[model samples]
Target: MAHFNKAFQFKTRSIIVLLTVFGFQLTAQNWDVPADKKAKNSYIKFDKTTASEGEGIYTKNCASCHGNPSKGNVLKSLKPTPPDLASSGTQKLTDGELFYILNTGRGLMPSFKDVLSESDRWKVIAYVRSFNKSYVQVLSNTDPTKSDKVKVTMVYNHETNTVRVQVVAKEQNTSLPLKDAEVLLFAKRYFGKLPIEKGLKTDESGVANFVYPKDLPGNKLGEVELLVKVNDEVYGEVESSTKLKIGIPTDKPGLTQQRAIWGVLAKAPYWIIALYLLGIATFGVFVLYLVKNLFDFWKKGQQ
Candidate 1:
């Protein structure tokens, strides 16, 4: 009976340890994608042409670490090695889930949201989907053409330091508000769009509000380019870019404006430029001396 008790205790401890490890892993890998993003469907149809175009794009962008689909040649050096796109693990993910993963990269993976165009990103997914034989795509019911009729307007308030966005779709002479839509606000940066805040849902009146950061720098005129993107069940997706004079005016000089070692050729420090030229002249003189000596040695040998 004592031996039986010991054995049962050991098994129970083992189960607890396994469960703890699994729970930790789940927490670590959790992406926390919103329900709407996970449910987003591709507006573009997945076809042979798209898949082909995606293949070229994938080869240029994704093939570095993910390797060719189904080849099983993923870059193993990475901590969490990239998975084979053709594998069951990748194939099982929903299209929206995959899209969200691509947009919000984790750990070693970098976000491709800014790097790839919306159409190109979907095409890359199409190429990835081509590897799975049993895969069937469910296209989005939202019409792409209807997105053109959607209008997005932004109003900034000085007192609240918030931007109010209104999204409406025009159907002939009627303008209907788009409520309960997914709205994301971004500030245009040199490289990519910087998200102002977490995505917000429109209210009953088809309005979403975002709190603008007070310290964000802008051009000399205190103008900042604000980009608003809206995704609705009815209107599909709409994007609007607007310039607002709300940012803190920053007239900071460019990095290369003054003379420095790292500055452009024309803007390099005079002392550093002189030293570089001196080094080049010294090398040239040394080469000439060596050649003259060699020539002298050859003349002596000939005599």
Candidate 2:
């Protein structure tokens, strides 16, 4: 009787522990999303438009591999079955993880880095989560409606050695400044790694400024390909073929002048002119020495 009671107590404790763990996992999964489920009085709004847009995007782009979301045909063919979007697996993933998978692609899924814009990718992810309760819960937790509408502008100036970046939030038909939006600027060079620069948020006008180094070692100032991102979403990118002319340092004016003079001299017959002057100077010195020797011999004979 005692042994049976001990075994029963052990089993009960084990069951409790398992239940607690499962509950924790569920809560954790739920917490990974933004906290706006009903779209009522929310900062970020989601509706049929976004979901339809996402469905269209997915059909055009993702359906080739993932298959029809409703049927899960293509997904089933894989060795390990792809998680059904309409099932519990969809809710099991965090919004960030889903975004990462959609954008970066894992295993057989191809990366959509070039194919989809960051915002569109997020929208599709939001749509995929709408299929099930778990996904809906996750989306509700990771609300896209909370995103501040931001406008981004990129300006590259070769003369000033600067890449001026601007970001603004659009609210109520008026543009308000977004302060402290992290800006990442990168310029790809021909021969080496891209130079990266980071800038802080704007003041009243929502502008961030990053100056390109006056002299990027081993890189000529020429057309540089640039990539810019704000809040992890790509803002805008531009490839400028602007040339950055080499500037002489203030302390090296003499060297600059010497270089200028030598450049002009190089264009002319400098070697021939130098040789001719050297020959004339040699002849003049020889003639003076010979005349002095002759005068000295005459004086000695007189003595």
Candidate 3:
């Protein structure tokens, strides 16, 4: 019947409008990449070493306020709850977009441009990605707990010509004394290519003693430079000079010896010697002139 057809048409039209509105809403909402796409390129090739470094950076610079992202310590009162980085929200964002946010900052978050290098920011991005279960699963597949440790420090002694250098292995809050660990020491000329001596281990107090030979050539009477290495893993360097002087007696000689040498050299008066030489020259010249005049007179008389 005509009425039935009208109802059917209305229903169909209503359904079509609803479908169109839903499509628009879905398009407006930003969704993450499809599961199939993620599966195809699940692994984001990044430097594992760099991510490990970013872990430390996160601990030092970001841990104070953010705590651990895994623990959900997000600041909710802020405009938008720090987007759950572990959730699809982060995955939906492209790497470049995420990088921009991290470098430029958003809301209360400070810009990391001045704080982190470009490579470092990428490392951090990799670390943030790791929060996602998919990425976490990938990381675990590679090796869940790979060792990622590094050391950065230099130590040495100048006076004793000894040194102990090693990488420090303590968190920012912790303090490690040089006495607690064993330090290694290596010896060589400051700028020498080859190491003059092999490596030596440190004592309980992390001290390494280096005694230079008294008769070592080139160093006997001048400054000796030595390169110190600790644990065979770090370099501790110091420039030390030997205390040796030749022809210079340690004890002062008696004044008599000095005066005797001076007396001998001063015995002949310089003024008297000069006057005697002048008188001899004058007498010789006078005798020569008289002989010449007598010879001239004899020649004239003979003529």
Candidate 4:
């Protein structure tokens, strides 16, 4: 009886631990996307050509973690093993859901929203869907050509230290305001674009306002290039760039202006240049002296 009771207790503990771990895994994998994002569809059609292009893109960007589709060679070292794209579980997810996951990554997954264009992201989805033989794509009703009709203008407010972005779509003879659209503003920098603030949604009047930083540095002329990206369900994605004279005027000296070891030869320190030339001259003189000595020794041998 004692042995039976001990075995029962051990089994209970084991079951409880397994349940706890399984519950945690379920919670981690649950990506609760909004209703709008879940319903969003791709403007690009899924075809063989686009799927082939997407395969190349996936090999470069996603294969490192997810591995090739249908292959069980995923990197299992990760805490939550990435699912194979060809697996039934992955194929069950809606196209919009897959897009949302790519845009808003969790844990070890990095967001590709900034890295890949909207067209490219859709192409990647097309490639993944290719693995599902029975999968049928539902194209978005949004007209991608309307993206060219979109116009975005940004204006800075001096007193409030804010930038106002207005979006409008022109069709026929009427200009319609684009309301409730997603807008992202960025400032161009030497290395990469810097986000001005958190992404904002346009209001009823098709305007989104962002607070600009007062301490942000600009060129000597205080000119900063601003880029705005607008995403609307009806118009797809549109981007516009403009230069503004709002940042702090910075006139920092160029890196190559001052003498540095990493600088160009012309920008190298005078002492370093002098030393290099002196070393070359000294080597030439030693070679000439050795040649003269050899010549004198030959003359003595002849004598």
Which one wins on TM-score? 1
Please report, in order, the local distance difference test score of every candidate based on alpha carbons.
0.89, 0.58, 0.50, 0.91
* lDDT, model 4, position 237: 87
Tens-place lDDT per residue, model 3, 60-96, is 7666556666776765554444555656766667665
Q: Output the worst ten-in-a-row residue range by lDDT, candidate 3.
A: 139-148
Clashing pairs in 2: 33-141, 33-142, 34-140, 34-141, 34-142, 34-143, 44-145, 180-201
Q: Can you write out model 2's per-residue Cα lDDT over 225-258, one digit (the tens) per residue? A: 5656665122222222223332222342333244
Ranking by TM-score: 1, 4, 2, 3
For candidate 1, the per-residue lDDT at 14 reads 99
For model 3, the stretches where C-alpha displacement exceeds 4 angstroms are 1-47, 133-303
Candidate number that wins on lDDT, 1 or 2: 1
Order candidates by lDDT, high to low.
4, 1, 2, 3
Against the true structure, candidate 3 reaches a TM-score of 0.29
TM-scores of all predicted structures:
0.61, 0.43, 0.29, 0.60
Report the alpha-carbon TM-score of model 4 versus the true structure.
Answer: 0.60
Residue 129 of model 3: what lDDT?
69
RMSD of each: 6.5, 21.8, 31.4, 7.6
